[model samples]
Target: MTEQLEKLNRLPLRDDLRGLTPYGAPQLDVPILLNVNENTHGLPQEVQDAITASVQRAVSGLNRYPDREFTELRTRLAGYLGHGLGIENIWAGNGSNEVLQQILQAFGGPGRTAMSFPPTYSMYPLLASGTGTRYVTGDRAADFTLSAESAAEQVRAAAPNIVFLCTPNNPTGTALGLDVVEAVYEAGTASDAIVIVDEAYAEFSHAGTPSALELLPGRERLIVSRTMSKAFALAGARLGYLAAAPEVTDALRLVRLPYHLSAVTQATANAALAHADALLANVEDIKVQRDRIVAELTELGLQPAASDANFVFFGGVEDPKRIWQGLLEAGVLIRDVGIPGHLRVTAGTEAETTAFLTRLRELLGA
Candidate 1:
């Protein structure tokens, strides 16, 4: 065998990954894709024009490396964040995932803990492993609400260095209300742990739900992570950021790669920012479609969680995997989350939603 192959075989990988199945996002080429929570709409024509113009300006500087600081991009992002917080509080990465990893690297490692909730984003646990940090979880209540007391107990017991809370949580589509989040945040603070709120779906949240950013005052240990991937429809460009106090941003900057955000990505995100109104309009439409899908699922005898995000989680029927398989065969792909008796589906375009509903009704004999 080659020298590289010999060394690879001899080296022992992380102990936790032993026998753990590798993860790859599902591959489904269908007329309707409801598996991943992606906005079905592309950037508007006006936004595309802006991107083209920005790209032209950037092309002349191809010989130079991207700005190591991503200062211009940060300025645009700080502007996006508005006067509420300035550039001192912002950190960006290739994606929100990387930003999350940097948080772990900065504060978490062997002998330290990273706490999260179950049926939340799977990436949290994976990210923890990459930093050699212990991953601890508090299971949500049966109704999918965050158990503030239980979470508090875990914080005290684990004494974790970092705690991740997913707002309008993934896989279940349930929003942990601000009061509960505050309770958890308070509990976590008792241990002097950092609380990272993963608000990847905040744009689709129900009105009146307070954003974590709005609650960041005096919460110096808090990091509210946001992504342009979901609401801005820029997943392809890979931009995500965290808003926190200057100290936290400084620590994150220490571990993050120098040129993590590319000029192309920075430019694309700036273009997207200029069309915020159009993006919010699309988000509202998704929310409307999400509500309708939840209702339709209920009428078909499926109990869906009260979702404030753009996806719906419904199940309690026979064999969610079999149902998911049937839907896939019928060309409608939904996410079969590992959670038993539960499946998550993203709301697509109106026509796509209709097609999925029709096929689902036929499959379930509704």
Candidate 2:
């Protein structure tokens, strides 16, 4: 390992890429794996069968390249989103991260800049780095919340070429109000910024939470990105899509590699979309578990943030590392998240949630 590290350092790597650690979470094989914020519930048997059948049908056409445009998948995604969106307004990539990277490639590079609030998604900076875009970090409240006024002010000040808004944000699990999106968009008018609202966990948000999709009609600069990984239990499918103005997608077309999405991937995602209701049934169950985690964690004297995502992030651990290790020893694994006193856990199934909670309680000696 030392030799490899020395050799890597000696190579002529980009100066900006030097000393940057890759983004990853611990991938431990534990009894209750709730670390990565994936849907704990496996796919419904029916959805699984549908995907299998679709893949089988697509197998014969393996020799041919997938439709570079992915027209059918875009249409299906638009119907699923249903904010009066159409195929012209839809674009997709292997995952939301790729969709975001493509955006940076199109709108940010060299002298251009991309900005996002910290303790948000860790990938924004990494993606910016990969695209050779200047990365900027904005501030959030001590409680990890961002207000519309603060966000707008920050956007106006930075005037970045691109802005990333992670709704029901990762790690922290808090959702931004549409007002923040509106404010940031208005503020970015001076820079003509492309604002992206990442809705990876939108399906798990509490009742009546409005989506940024509602704000996309006239906002050609705004993009709302979604993934089939969480709510649809299709993490292996690797399908992420966005809804934006046709012109914005047109901009992406210049940068995206031809036939980037594979035929099997399209089949799997399309089949999942066909069974959206069945696949999303687990979302309600996960929400129940998430709320349970928040309530029970509070009762145990931990300060869990209000979460609209599938995961719960809580502070008040006197020793986060100790608790994390203790939970691991007991065969339950959750994310330590590197925060001083906070840890994040994906809400799992009823039994899995019970396992995590019971182990956590035992660790706390409660």
Candidate 3:
């Protein structure tokens, strides 16, 4: 082997990722985009103009690096969250995915383990493996609801260094109750594990669902991560923030590269914040679309789980690939999850939803 190849082979690349390709969602242009859970709406003209104006005003400062601390953006985000946790307890990264990695780097590695439930976000295991930490799975029960008792038992047994829980979980589109979150946090406390709750879709959740921020007061190990990618309609900006104890935020700061946020990204994010109401209105529309999709799928004899997130997850058919292929060929795109016979369809514009439903009905011969 060449010198470089020999040196690369000597490093302990985690065996879990030996044959796995890097993670990514398909980005092909199609008639309808219901694959990646992106908000169907784009920034309003006013917001776009404001962002452009902001960028133009700061064009002179392009030569200088952005503030490493990102204080202004942090303050805006703090105000947006409207929780007790202030900017002092906030941290930002290139994306929430990076924030997840920073949590693992700070609390888990080598002999330490990161615990999570399966049929959840696919990134948890990937993040754990990248940090050279053991990824422990506490598979959810048959109904796709988490078994807190079983999960707590696993936390007690494995004693992982970090725990990741995704509320309004991806692919499954199931939101764990606050009670379940508290139970898991309490369990992690017993083991002194850092519990990171990924609430990327918190905006789409049903009314009355408590945010993890509510638990930040007494739970020092609880870290709640939010992303502008989903509800805020700023996925292109690549901004995510985590709120937790100041000490936990400090730990993440230790590893985050300086000036992770670019001038344009920060400017656009601030613009998005200025138009928060507009984004939220869009989210409300998505919720309505979500409900309609779930009902439609149920009518077709498919059992879609009750979802508060922007997507619907259903199972029952022995092979969903036919449905998936049918949609694909018809120029509609959606996500097929790991669970056998399960599929995830994200809510899009009204027109897109109508086309998807029409295609779906034809595929199922309804």
Q: Which candidate is the best by TM-score?
A: 2
Q: Which candidate is the best by lDDT?
A: 2
Each candidate structure's TM-score, on Cα atoms with residue i matched to residue i, is 0.94, 0.99, 0.94
Superposed model 2: Cα runs more than 4 Å off: none
Which lDDT values do the candidates have, in the order given?
A: 0.84, 0.93, 0.86
Score residue 286 of candidate 1 by CA lDDT. Answer: 90
- Candidate 3 off by > 4 Å: 1-17
Winner on TM-score between 2 and 3 is: 2
Q: Clash pairs of candidate 1? A: none
Please give, for residues 287-320, the per-residue lDDT of candidate 2 as tens digits.
9999999999999999999999999999999999
Candidate 1 lDDT score at position 46: 85
lDDT for model 3 = 0.86
Using TM-score as the yardstick, the better of models 1 and 2 is 2
Candidate 1 TM-score versus the reference:
0.94
**lDDT by residue (tens digit), candidate 1, 71-145:** 877778888876488888888998899899999999998988888888889898889888898998877678777
